[model samples]
Target chain A: MRINPKTLEEVAFKLLEKAATSLPDDVKKALKSAYEREDSPTAKTELKNILDNIESAEKLKKPLCQDTGMISFYVRSREIENFVEVRKALIDATVKATETIPLRPNAVHPITRKNTGNNVGEHIPHIEWIYTDQDHVELIASIKGGGSENMSALAMITPGLGVKGVKKFIVDTVVKAGAQPCPPTIVGVGLGGTVEISFKLAKLALLRPLGSRNKDKDISRLEDELFNLINQTGVGPMGLGGKTTCLDVKIEYAHCHTATLPVAVYFQCWADRRASAKISLDGSFEFIV
Target chain B: MVEYRLKTPLKEDEVRKLNVGDILYITGTIFSARDQAHRRILEYAEKGLELPFNLDGAVIFHVGPIMQRKDDRWVVVSAGPTTSTRMNSTTPKLLERFRVRVIIGKGGMSFEVAEALKRFGAVYCHFTGGAGVLAAKNIKEVEGVEWIDLGMPEAVWKLKVEDFGPVTVTIDSKGRSLYETVKKSVEENLKKIYQQI
Candidate 1:
């Protein structure tokens, strides 16, 4: 059985619309907790404003952010028969959604600086595919804003520096990026992979639900330690000064050569817009969130 | 810590009176420009070419809003502030050449810009970065736009705003920078964390 391209396009458009206006359950919960835990009046007010903005955007069916962001797709599939059509459907749907959902024309040439005007340009809507034993395709769509993307960092430490160095680097990145990426921000820390893969791992780490803990107890402990270390910087909500600088810390690691330990830190603002769905062969779909 | 209600065509003294942490609710006309737009403006300055709009006593907003066409007219959908640091290199020149009284953006500017703001009697205000929907609600009109060749995100958006901000002064004409202060305090916190670890 195979899903028709038109149905895929329809599903993709619906996913983009939801990604723009709705907040995921886990992220909403995290924001509510941050608001409750906040102490400083200024920070508390900022959090309240952010929550209000979320609610208003939902009600009005408008994007929560101006920089609608570069769209990304992570697909895990095994039994999808028209794989080629699936790719084209995703691209076509993205262009269609640009006008319907009214997403910003975010793709532009780096050198000539030409706007594609359709949110479809060279390597935009970056689609990454992963194969799994599953019989259906699971798709996760995320809109990564510019301000938060600007705060991403990559650090290479000597082998002797160890995990301690990674912690220091992550904390330093958050401090240097104070108020720039919009706190209380979600932090994704990638450990051990080489230069390029480390950055990719950090970004992929952001796909994990906010409150979900890592399977590795040791890594989960590290995530908690870094979370506490980052909040200790006193960056607070919108960097105004508060106790809740970071909402959550997620870590992912891959084995690498013994010579160097490369770490990457990725930040996502409170907007944290992402949604997922499972696509079936009968031209039907159900949202994962 | 004062609260100000400023209108565009801002006066020098009005901007000079702002201090770090002062809140402002601004009204009137303002132009939006980001990284590429700033470069084009500076290029115009170097060539001694006349700018498309008057800059003297004007306020500049750092944004790349998402807009949609409705009833054959364009309307801003989400118009939140962008990071100011990206414009730091070109800002002092813009301030010096245009005599802009106020700059509204997120993220603070550099020490160089702080000095320039002091020299030019200007101030930098920070609007909440992710509050794009709220920001759009405050816009009264989209008067006009230019530099379409620079693309939508880099285009110069001329907006008519009314009581359009819950912005805070992050950099004032007195050379005070809230970001710098935050950095210092963060360093102190980092020191304590290092001891704990």
Candidate 2:
């Protein structure tokens, strides 16, 4: 049973709309817990406002943030019979979503700085493909705002410093970022790998649900330690000062060359908008929250 | 911290009375401008060109809103604050030339901008980051727009708002800044974390 292109387009459009208009359940839970744990009145007020905004967006069925963000799709499938058709359908979905959902046209020419006006441009609506043996196709959509994305960092450290070096780098990045990235952020750290891969992994790590731990024991422990250290910074919500600086720290790693340790950190502001769906070969689909 | 309701065309005395950490709910007119709009405004000033809108005693917002044209009128779908730090270099000049009373944005501006706010009798207020829907609900009308050639996000959107905030005064005319306070504390905490590592 081959999936129809129209069905793919419909699913993709729905995923984009869902990702933009609502907060995922895991993220909402983390924010509620943060609000409860917060001490400072200012931080509490900020958290309250955030919660209210989420409620308002859901109720109004509006885009959660003005910066609907540059959309990216992560696709996993068993086999691709026609890659071009699939890619075209995804682009068509993006255009339709932009008009109906009225997403802010975020894509532009990097050098010339010309607006594409439809949120589609060169290599945009970027698709990252992963192949699997599964019979159905899984699509994950995420919208990352410019403020938090601007705070992303990468460092090449001397291997002698080990995990100590990695911890220091992570803390330093968050501290320097301060309230700029919008505190109580979900910090995604990609350790090891090459230069580009490190940053990619960092962004990919952000796709994980808050409070989920890494499969590796050491990495999971580091995630907890970093989470605590970041919160201790007292940057709080919107950097006004409080104990809930970061809601969670997620780490993803890959083995690297012997002499170099590469670390990258990506931030996802509390909005943390993302959605996923699984499309069966018969054209039926189900959202995975 | 004290809470106050402010309206646009703000007076110097009212802005001067505000201090770091004060809360504000602003009404009246506010103009939206992001990075490109800032640069364009200055460029127009340099060329001795008349600006389409006035900035004197104005409330300037750092935002790139999502808007739609519904039949005959424009509707704000989402209008939230953008990071102000990106406008740090251009702000001091804008404050000097325009005497903008309030700067509404998320995150915070640089120390120099805080100082400029002091010298210019202005204040920097922080809106809740990513709270776009709440902001749109508060925005009552699109009064007009300017420099739309710069693209939708970069265009200057003149708006009329009602109780448009729960914005906190992060930097006041007195030169004190809540961001600076937070930064100092973060540094001290970072020292301890570094030692542990």
Candidate 3:
């Protein structure tokens, strides 16, 4: 089974557009719950309006939010060559779409003071490739909204604090960040790995199924404790106070330096707007509905 | 509840009578600016340009929104509010330099901004963040774009608006902020809820 470049570009571009306009079921579920649970007549009304906007945007094939974050893709490839060509074609496509599709441009170098106008920058589609035994590719795209991205936190504590420390950090950060990151978020907690690695792991954790487990028993149990403790924050739907503060807490961990215990907590708004696709060696791809 | 629609060049006495939670469907003229413009305003204060508009009874909205195609011009798409905290460091300077009477945005302001609001007889209003579309309905026209070079979502957009509904007073004229109240309550609730479990 061999994948071709043409199919990859075709599949990738379409997935990007669909992800922008359509709200996944998990996201809709979380949003609906938030709308129903919101208590402030003002905030509640606002949430309801947001929901209506989401539905209409999807129906009209328009962007859900004007901020349409910088597009980032994570691809798992196998025996793939011409990777450079693949990147060029995608960048061209992204730029073209910036005008044709008219996606808002959000990518700018921190200091250079340059705007890509197209979301693609120097290392634009920023791809992280994973190696697997088979001849297939699993690619996922997630939009990193600035508000929530700014709320991500990492703390290196003594190994002694363990789950207790993790719980406290998660709750404290969310409470302090109330409504800032857009609450009732899907939390991605990365444990173990080095500082940067752990932060990356947490961001990657967001790609997993909303309520799915890590498959490792210890990690799974820790996720449950953190999830329960987080929702208990009662930061509520929009921080107006409600039973559901977090839709789910996904944990991704890696072994770390013996003396170092690093952890990262990343939050994705209820939009949780992301989509994944599987490309078989035969050059066929299917989006995870 | 008090409501008034006045132009720029506001008077302090008119500003003093306004209270928190009072619904103001502000008409007349208001200037829009976000990160870049705020930074420039600070620079303007140091060099001292006559300033763009009268600030006494005027409202300043912190926004950088989507540009949509109108019949012949660009329009605001969900041109709703952005986070106000990011501008906290500049609000006091903005108020004192310009004598701004109203600061409209989402999220709350810092203590310094609150003090400035009280001292200046101004108030902070929290318009919905994602309600750009609904907020645009209040805006009758774009007026024109100020800094086109800043690019979308960063450029300073001047808009003439009508009755934009649903913008509530989160931070008030008397120096009390609803965001702070709710945030403080959230902290207490978290301590109580997590302390036991």
Candidate 4:
């Protein structure tokens, strides 16, 4: 089935707009739950204010965070006839969304520090395409906020150190990151991969819904254990000292060389901005949460 | 734990009285500066050039607001605090040269910046990060902007604010720092956790 470029652009713009102004249902639920579990008075107030901010942004149709974040598109598609058109549509939609949704002009040239103003520079809205067997195309759009993005870390450990070493690295990153990543953060851990692949997996893990566990029992156990250890550090909401420092911890792993264990830790602030959509050959699109 | 309503062009006494963890609802006027604006201010100080705005007793917010035109005037859509540590390299100079009494941002700054805050009789305040929409509600007006060439995020925004904060004093003039305390306590806990593992 061939999808029209115009239809794809429209769908992309809607996804970008929705991703900017509203928190996903899973993220909203997690924040509410965190607010209830938070023990510190300051943390509770911080959580309440964040919840209020989310509601106001949604109601007013404005961005939930000022940063607006760098746009990322993760696409899972079957054989589509208009693949090239789809790419162009995604780019055009980003420019249109910048003006209509009025996103902050976040794309800047590294050497000269020139802002593109339209949120589209060279590779500004990062797109990753994954082929699948499904007849329809599914796209997951996520915004990686600057505050949390700054805290991403990777460590190459010797295989002898094992899971215990990975745990310490993740915990230390969270500790040092502290209030910088804007706790209670959603932590994504990638283990057993090479340097770059591990980091990619770490970010991919964030696309998973909050509170969902890895299918592997061992990995899921690590997620649960790390979740508690991170929260116990008392970094709390906005790192103001509390019982609920981390809302969730997710782990994604890949096979690595026998000699090296590369672990990447990524954090997403509680804003947790993301949305998904499915597009059919008839040029129709449906938002999935 | 005390809540205080502070007006800008703040007095030394007003700044000195702030303790770590005190909630503040600051009013009056405040200027916004991120890393680039701060660097320019330091450069201006170096060249002995007169600044576009007065800095004495000023409260500088670390932010890059999302502004759009509304009814022929600029309105802030969202204006949350940026991380302050990124500006730590320039903050001590800004504090000393500008005599800024209050610095507001998210996450805490480093020891050097904290010490500068102490020496200058200033305090570092922290607003909730990513609560840009909530913060925008407190901004009553966009007075003017300077260094437009620095781009939106890097420009110096003069804002008129009223009861403009749901902020906490994270680093106080008396050498007390909530971030430092938290880090130290967390380190102690890490020791125990590591042993258990």
Candidate 5:
């Protein structure tokens, strides 16, 4: 089955708009509960401000944060004939969204630091593909701001150190990142892969909805353990000090070489902006979040 | 923990009175300068060149707002704090060169910046990170802009704002820092967690 490139472009543009302007429901619910349970007046104020900011952005149809963020599209399809066309359409959508949604032109040259004006540049609007037997095309758009992105970490640990080392690294990263990534953050942990794969998995793990556990019971238990350990730090909202530091911790893992253990951690700030859509071969699409 | 409504071109006396954790709602003019702009400011000062805008007693917001041109004027769609820690190296010098009374951003700054705040009679404030729309709503006007060649985000935007906060003082002129206090406790907590896990 084939879908029109124009339809894909429009869908991609709307996804960018939706991702930028609205905080996902799962994130909102987590934040609301964080606010309810928080004890520190300062932490509560920060959370309240965030809640108010979300409301204003939705009401006014404005981008949620000034850092509209680097865009990434995760596409999953079983059989699609227009892979090249799909890529082009997504880029075109990004260029259009930069002006209409008025994203902050975040993409820049690494060396010279020249702004691209539109959010597109070399290797930008990074598209990741997954092939599945699904009947419909699944596209997930995630926008992550620089502050949180800067906090991402990759650690190569001794194999003998095991899960305890992984847990230590995760907590250390969060405490080190205190207040910068805009807590209460949602942490994504990627474990037991090659260096790059671990980092990629960590970022990909962020696409999962808050409160969703991994299918693997061991990993799910590990997620719960880290979540509690992080919150116990009292790093709190905006890291000024309070009870809740992390709203949720999501983990994704792959089997590693017998000699190596690589762990990567990624943080999504409180905004946690993302949206998903399922596009049918008939050219119809529905936003899932 | 006090709340004060301040107006810029703020006096040193007023800034010195602020304590860590005090909330401020500021009025009048402020300028937005990120990493690049901060570099340029120091460069210009070193070259003995005059700046396009005044920095004396100014509020420097570490933001790169999403701006749009409607007719002839620039409108701010969203303006939020960028991480201030990135500016730590240059900030002490900026404060030393000018009477920059309030430094507003997120993630706080280093002990060096806190020391500079103490020395220069200024305070570092945090405008809740990622609260862009809220920040823009309080910004009344884009009074002017400079260094457009530096690109939209890096350009020096002279903003007119009113009640432009709920910004909290995280590092005060007295050398007390809310971030430092929190960091100590987090470290202590980290030690405990390490022992358990």
Candidate 6:
């Protein structure tokens, strides 16, 4: 059984590029819904413009924005009896994809603050392994851009803050962010962990479908409440005033310290970039691309 | 909010007409320079070198564009507004040195830049941040690059643009700011709504 690391990378590279130009189906549906419910004239106009932009991007093969974001992927690979060239393949794939897909070289020198000439860097384009052993490698590719990435938040408040305080903090963060995150955003909220874990979990929560309801009854109830409160801020589509400030409010939680209430909020823009693939140990592969 | 359609070599009277929140679709040639290139341009101006683009009444968009491959040519990727606060320190220097009239970017501008825009008869125009694809359509063409070696993202892209839709004058010549208005209003509203019943 053998897997072509070169092919895997090319697929990943092309997937990232496609995701930039093509809005995910879930995200598209959410925006269309947001446009229908948006009350502010200005916000509505912005929403329509965004939809139009999406259409043009698909038709003309132009990126949804000029700043096609930095590409990041999450991989879950399994060890089989064969395959020695996995690591080399991955690196070669990155460089190959960098040329083929031509991802904007986003990785920079940590100190000099200069681009690394390639998107690949020490910790960049991180490939987090999900630890699935099914005789194959499965990768989830996400092209996280800058604007929404800049809006990420984490709080290690006292236990006294509780869920209500958590709600208040999340609202403040998004409201203050205003139009900065690109309105009708998909918010990923992670609760109860160490500060770093909370931040990571919060970002992971963004992978959920746009309007899917949380299975946890208690968390789902909170999700509804926060979603309503956020939209009430009237920071519509582009912060020009609107009812649908966010397309969805996603929450994730883990066990925490006795005195700590760690919280994080990660915002995903309307672009909502993501794609995935599965490569079998038998050289067969499938990708969202 | 004031709306005007004027050509280059813009005068003080033209500058005086724009008010905060006024949406202007400016036409003409503008030089696009982001962080790295801005640093180089300022360094060049210090050494008394002529700028790549004519400075008088010129607009400088603070953007670093992404490149896409299109049949032997590299095109712009999603080039949207970056945080403009990063430019606060460099911008006044650029405005004073280069005589730049209009600045386009996202987020808030610095006090010094705002003050300079007013004093020097310039205006700080803000396009809707994150709407790069929409903004690109208004760009008629990429005239050329000054420093091609700077790579695709950091290069100083000269763009000929027309009616780039829906850019607001967040900072006007008379010294007004839409951010200030919104922030003040939000603050005032925050106090009223959150006050203990």
Q: Each candidate's lDDT (Cα)?
A: 0.87, 0.90, 0.72, 0.89, 0.92, 0.73
- TM-score result, candidate 2: 0.98
Tens-digit lDDT track of model 4 for A1-289: 5667887788888999999999999989989998998776788899999999999999998998999889998888876777788788888999988877888888889998888888888987998888898888888888778889898898998789888998888888998899999888999988887998998898888999998999999999999999988887887888778887888999999999989999999999998998889988777789996
Cα deviation of B123, candidate 2, in Å: 0.5
Ranking the candidates on lDDT from highest down gives 5, 2, 4, 1, 6, 3
lDDT of 2: 0.90
Total backbone collisions for each predicted model: 0, 0, 5, 0, 0, 7
Interface RMSD of each: 1.0, 0.8, 2.3, 0.9, 0.7, 2.9
Which pairs clash (backbone N, Cα, C closer than 3 Å) in model 1? none
In order of appearance, the predictions have TM-scores of 0.97, 0.98, 0.90, 0.98, 0.99, 0.89
Q: Write candidate 6's Cα lDDT for A106-145 as tens digits.
A: 6777677667767777866666656565677776777776
lDDT (Cα, 0-100) at A45 in candidate 2: 90
Clashing pairs in 3: A2-A281, B10-B57, B78-B132, B78-B133, B79-B132
Which fraction of the native contacts appears in each prediction? Answer: 0.72, 0.87, 0.27, 0.71, 0.93, 0.39
Cα lDDT of model 5 by residue, A193-276, tens digit: 899889888887899899999999999999999999999999999888999899999999999999999999999998898999
Residues B60-80 of candidate 5: C-alpha lDDT, one tens digit per residue: 999999999999999999999
- Poorest 10 consecutive residues of model 1 chain A by lDDT? A1-10
TM-score of chain A of each: 0.97, 0.98, 0.91, 0.97, 0.98, 0.90
DockQ-better candidate, 4 vs 5: 5
Preferred candidate (DockQ higher): 5 or 6: 5
The Cα RMSD across the true interface for model 4 is: 0.9
Tens-digit lDDT track for model 2 on A162-225? 8998998898898888888888899999999999889889888999888899999999999999
Model 1 residue runs over 4 Å out of place are none
CAPRI level of candidate 3: acceptable
Query: Local error of candidate 4 at A144, Å?
Result: 1.4
Which candidate number has the best lDDT? Answer: 5
